[model samples]
Target: MADTLRHYGPAAVAWVLLAYRVSKGRRGAPDPARDTVWLVLLGLSLSLTLLTPAVYAFTGRVSGVPNLARLLGHGSMLVVAWSARTFLWHLNHPITEVQPRTRLHLGFLAATFAAMSVLFVLADTPVDDARFAARYAGDPWVLEYWLVYIAYLTPAFASMAVLGWAYAHMSTAPLLRVGLRLVAIGAFLAIGYNLHKALVFASERFGFSYPPAGHLLIDGVLPMLAHLLVLIGATLPAWGRLVNAPESLAWLSRYRTYQALRPLWRALYAASPHIALTPASPALVELVTVRDLNLRLYRRVIEIRDGRLALMPYLDLDTATAARARAAQAGLSGQALDAAAEAAALHAALHAKALGATAVFGPASHTPGGGDLDSDTVFLRDVARAFHRLERQSHHG
Candidate 1:
C-alpha cells in the first residue's frame, strides 16, 4: 500500500494541478506567478512519473543506459525546485530586482546540473536498479552524486519553506494564505526527505546498515506526502475562481436559505392556505426536489411575507414585548433577540388564529426590517431558526 501510494500519489497530484492550471489559464490574462507555478507543477509531474518503478525500468531499458531514469528524475526535481524559487522571487520582489537574481540562480542550477551529470557518468552503475541508491550505496561516485543532489536540494527547500511561511503571513487573501502555508509545510517535509536520504547514503558509505523500511518511507511515502501538500497549496488559490465560482456559491447560499425557511413557511402556510400562490409539496417530495431553486426561493420568501401580513391582526404587542424581555434575560442580543421576539409573537399569533379568536387590534402594521431581498432572506432565516428552537422548547415544556 505504501509503495503504491508513493508511486502514484505525487504523479496524480501533479497531473491534477497541471490540468487545473491549464483550464484556469484559458479564462484569464497571462500571469507570471501562475506561469511559474505551471512550470513547477510540470517539473513535479515529470519527476514523479519518471521515478515510478515501471517508467524507471522502461526508460533504462529503452535508453540502454543503467538507471538513466534516476538522473532524469533528479534533473526534473532540480527544475521543480528552481521554478518554485523563481515563482516565490517573482511574487515577493520587483521585476528589476528579480531579473539579476534569476540569472544568477539559473547559472548556479546549470552548474549543479552539469556536476551531477558528470558524477552520474563516472559512477559504475552498469545495471538498471529500481533501488538505485541502496544498490550503489557504497560506490564512491554514486555517493558523490547523491551528496551533490542533496547539496542542491537542501538549501533550496529550506529557503522555500522560510519564504513560503513569511509570504503566507504577509498575504491578505484567505485562500492564498492557506496555499502558501501548505507549500511551506511541503517544503519542510521535503527537507526531511532530503536529510533521510543523505543519512541512508552516508550510513551505507560508512559500512553501517540502515533499516530497510526507512527506504520506503524516504523514497515513496515522504516524497508523495510532500508533493501532495505542495500541489494542493499551488492550486488552492484558484479554487474560488475555478471550482467555487461566485454564481455557484450564491446558488448554494440561496438553496440553504430556502431550506432554512421551511419550518416557518410550513407553519404560516397551515394557518393561512391562501398566502401561497401554489399548493405546498409533501415534505419528503420538497426535500428531494431542487428544480428552479432561485424561483422557488423567491416564491417562498414572498409567500412568507404575505403569511406574516395575514397573521398581523392576531400579533399581540404585549406578547412581543414580553418575549423580547425574556430573550434579553436569556442572553440573546442583536439579531438573536429580534428573531426570538418575532418567533414568539408569530407563535402566539398562530395559536390565537387556531383558537378562532377575532382580531383584538385591527391589523397591527409591521414589516420585516430589510431593504433588499438578500437581507430579507437573511433576517427570515434567523427568524426561522428561532421559530424552530421555540417549537422544540414548547414541545419539551
Candidate 2:
C-alpha cells in the first residue's frame, strides 16, 4: 500500500491538474493542439501509473491474456512518445511547417506498437510469473520488447529535455522560463530512468549480475522520482498563475468601481460638500488604497443619498416615470432601469434646488430603494452612466 501510494499519488495529482487545465480553456496560447497532446501524454502516464498495482495483483490473469497489462503499458508509452514528438515539433515551428514528417513519426510509432503487440501475443511465457520482465529476460521476444520500447522512450525524453532547455533560454517571460526550466530538469531525470533500463538489459544479455545499488535504486526509486518531478513541472505555470490571479483581480475590480462612481459622487459633493462626515481628498488619491477605497465609496454613496434627500421636494414623479420609460426603451432593465430612474429623479431635483425651489413634502413621503452600501455602489455606477442623458432630457422639457 505504501509503495502504491508512493507511485500513484502524484499520478492522481497529475490527473486533477489535467482536468483543471482543460476546464480553463485555451485562448491566446501558441499551438492549441500541443496543449491537447501534452494532456494526452500526462493522462497516459497517469493511467499507466495507476495500472502498476493492478498488474501486480492480477499477473496470472494478465499473463494469461499474453500479459495484456504489459502490452497496453508498452502501447501507452509509445503513444506518449508520439505525442511528445508532435508537441515538441509544434512548439518549435509555425503552422505553415509541413506536417508530413510529423505524420511519419506518428505512423512509425504506431507501427512499432502494432508489431510489439503481435510479438507479445505470440511469445510463450510462464503465466503465473509476477515479475515478468526479470523472469522472461532470456526470451528473445521479451528482450526485443525492452530494447524497442526503450529505443522510443529514450530519444523522446532526450528531445523533450533539449527542447525545454532551448525554450527556457529563449523565453523572456519569468513564469514561462521557470516552467521550462523545471520541465528540462524533470526530463533530464527521466533520461536516467531509460538509462537504468538499458543497463538492466545489458546485464541480462551479457550474464553479469547488476550491482545491489543498481537493483535497489534503478528499479525502486528512479521512475517514481522522475514522474513526480515531471508532474510538478507540468503543473507549475497554471498553479502559480491561479494562486496570484484572484487578489490581483479583486484589487482591479475595486479600483474600477471607485472610478465608475466618480461622476455622481463629484456632482453631489459639489451641491452639498458639507454633508460629508470627514473632509475628502482628491478622487485619484482616495482610490489608490484598496482599504480606504471601500470607505471612500461608502462615503460617496451616503453623501449622494443625503444630497438627494435635501432636494427631494423638487423631484417630479411624472418626469421621472417618463425618463424611466425612455431608459427602458433604450434597453436598460433590472437594477440599471432603477438606476436610470434614480438619475433622472436626482437630476430634476438638483435643477430645482439651483432655482431656489422650496420643499413640498417631508422625509416621510420619500421612498428608498432597499440597499446596503455595496449594492448601492453597484447601482450608483449604472446611475452615473445615465446621468448625462437624464440632465439633457430634463433641460429639453
Candidate 3:
C-alpha cells in the first residue's frame, strides 16, 4: 500500500537476486551474451535499490517514477558498459546468432548514453544557469528518462521480432518453448511501460504545467509497475514453470529453429516429410564445417512405439543391370552368380548399420537397402508414445 520493504520490496529484492544468481543457466558452459543480459538487469536492480531510498527522502515533492527514471539512466550506464564488454567477449571467442545482434544493441545503448549525456550537459553546464537551476535542480535529464526508456524499447522490440521470426528453427524440448514465450510476453510488457512513459511526456499540457485529479500516472503509478517488471523478470526462474522451461524454450524464439537443419537431413533421403510446421528466419550457418559426407539422413523422428529408419544400399540401376547381364552370361557357362548377389546383400547390411537402423525390407532388385516405411509418420510418434506407455507399465508393475 505505502510501498514498504515487507510489502513488496523484499520480494522484489529476492527475485532480483534469483535472476542474478540463477540465470547463468543450469548445466551449460557460460554464454557471455546471456551473462551480459543478467548483469545489466542486476545492475539496473542495484541502481533501483539505491535510488528507491533517495526517492523516499524526496517523496512528497518529486515523483518516485521520475526518480526511478534518473536511476535507470544511471544504472543503464553500467548495463551499456557491460553490454559492450559482452560484445568484446563474443568477438574474442564466438557466439553465432547473438554477435551481430549484440552489436546492434550496443549501437542503441550508445544512442541512449549520448542522449542522456547531452541532456545532462545541457542542464548542468554554466552556459545556462537559469535553465540549469530550473531544470537540473528539479527534473534535470527528464528527457534522459524517456530516451533511456526508448533505447531499451529498441532491443525489446528487436528481440521479440527477431525471436518470433527465428522461433521455428529450434530443436529442443517442449517446456522450453513455453519458457521462451513467457519471456517474450514479459518483454512485451516492458515495452508497453516504456512506450507509455514516452507518451506521458509528450505534452506538458496533460498536467506537467498544471495538476491532475489525484496524481500523474508516470510520476505516481509507474514506479510500482517498474518494480513489478523487475520482480517478474527476476522471479520467473524460481517458478516451477521456468525451472522446467530452459530445457526447451531458450531455443524457441518467436522464430522457429527446426527448419534450418532440414536440408541436411533431406540430402540423405530426398523425400523428407514436413511434420512440424513453423515460421522461417534467416539462415545462420554453424561456424564449423561438418565434414562427414557419407551421412545419410532417412530424416526420421522417433516417438517411442515403433521406428522405421531401416536403411539399405541399392546398386545403381545401370550397375545392377550390367551385373545381372554379366551374371547371366556367366550362368550359361556354368559359373555361379552367388558372388554378385552376396556383394549386394553385404552392401545393404552396411547401409542399415550406418543409418542406425536394425531392420531392412524390400527386394534386392527393387528398393535396394530400404525398409518397411509406414509412410504416415506414425513410426516416430508411435515409438515415442510407446516408450511413455512402457515407463508407466513398468512403474505400475
Best by TM-score: 1
Per-residue lDDT tens digits of candidate 1, residues 84-116?
888888888987898898788788889889999
Q: After superposition, which runs of candidate 3 have C-alpha atoms over 4 Å from their true positions?
A: 5-11, 14-16, 19-28, 54-74, 77-97, 124-141, 148-152, 155-158, 161-171, 205-397
Return the lDDT, model 3, position 372.
53
lDDT of 2 at 73: 61
Candidate 2 lDDT over residue span 1-397, tens digit each: 8677765665676677677777766668566444745654465664455356565447447445645666776677667656655665666687567277567777778778877876776667746354565777666577677667777777778887888788867866555566567666767776787676666666776778754564665666766676666666655656667677445545666778777766766667677777778776676676565677667667777777786776667778876788789889999888877888888888777777777888677334444354676676777777877886655565697
- Model 3 over residues 1-397: C-alpha lDDT tens digits? 5645523473366445656467545557766744554664565555455445444335313442333334343545346343534533442355776677667766766676666656654543332221122244335455455566466655654455346324412514344234334434544555665565554454332345432444344444454554454444333444535455554343332112223223322222332233322222223542232322112112232211011132233223454455546667756222123334323333334344556664434454542221353332222222223223433454698
What are the clash counts of all predictions, listed in order?
0, 0, 30
List the candidates ranked by lDDT, beginning with the highest.
Answer: 1, 2, 3
Ranked candidates (TM-score, high to low): 1, 2, 3
Q: Regarding lDDT, does 2 or 3 come out ahead?
A: 2
Please list the residue runs of candidate 2 whose C-alpha ends up more than 4 Å from where it truly belongs after superposition. Answer: 28-30, 41-43, 55-66, 128-130, 212-214, 244-397
Q: Score every model by TM-score.
A: 0.60, 0.55, 0.42
